[model samples]
Target: MILKRLILIAIVVLFSCSHTVKGQAPDAVKKTFQAKYPEENDPDWHKDDHGYYEANFKIDGIKYRADFNADGTWVETETSIDEDDLPDAIKKVIKEKFDDEKITEVEKVESATKGLFYDVEFKRKGKNKDVEFRADGTILN
Candidate 1:
């Protein structure tokens, strides 16, 4: 009897510790995510380090994730952007400066604090490098 009671207590503890952030998110968070991504549904939700919620979902064959607060406020969004989809100005800079480098991956980072920027990763002769650029094609770092 005592063993059964301990097992039941352990089950309760496991359930209580789980925040239940799975499958569907809260209504407020769903609304927030929907406002920006109208066509997306059933996002995989997880709690972020900053006490915000992150929703991971796919759109048009591209992977995207957006973060939000409990009150349905937008925190930030990161989308896997194709290298060819980069803005003309950014492409121009890469063509001129990194003629031989291969663009491995590009991300569109939109944040509330820092605003918008492109986080680009490129490869050259088995070496990888990362760069941050403003919308006007100025390299920030």
Candidate 2:
């Protein structure tokens, strides 16, 4: 009888602790992102199954997606450029340079890739041009 009672108490304690862990809110996740990526602005967060949060935001106009732990540290990030937001001139240049080239990736940067240019990665004529184009689609050095 005593063993059964002890087991029941243990089960109850474990259940309560699990509930507390699962009940953590989205704000906690937000706080975690803020603490880690201090310069990030206006992040969007939502809950997902398996008791965790996901966040989406832009850094330097480049979109990024991040997943956080229940306690709010980053798990991983997927970063990319929003091609639709690219300027028309740049798009035109991309189309003209490689007629058969299909853009695989685009990124906007200020310094790393030299100025605010689009680092477009594409394949054409069986060759790949990971070319950088200005906002106006002018190829950069």
Best by TM-score: 1
Cα lDDT tens digits for candidate 2, 1-141 = 999999999999876544332223456677777786899857666555555566667877768766677766556665667778778998787677676767777765543225456677785576766887778778875
Model 1 TM-score relative to the real fold: 0.62
Alpha-carbon local distance difference test for all models? 0.84, 0.67
Model 1 misplaced regions, further than 4 Å: 1-20, 24-26, 49-51, 95-103, 122-130
Candidate 2 residues lying further than 4 Å off, grouped into runs, are 1-37, 40-79, 124-127
TM-score of 2: 0.42
Task: List model 1 lDDT by residue over 17-78, tens digit each.
Answer: 65548755678888878888989877888876677788888987878878888888898899
Candidate 1, residue 114: the lDDT equals 71
* Clash number for candidate 1: 0
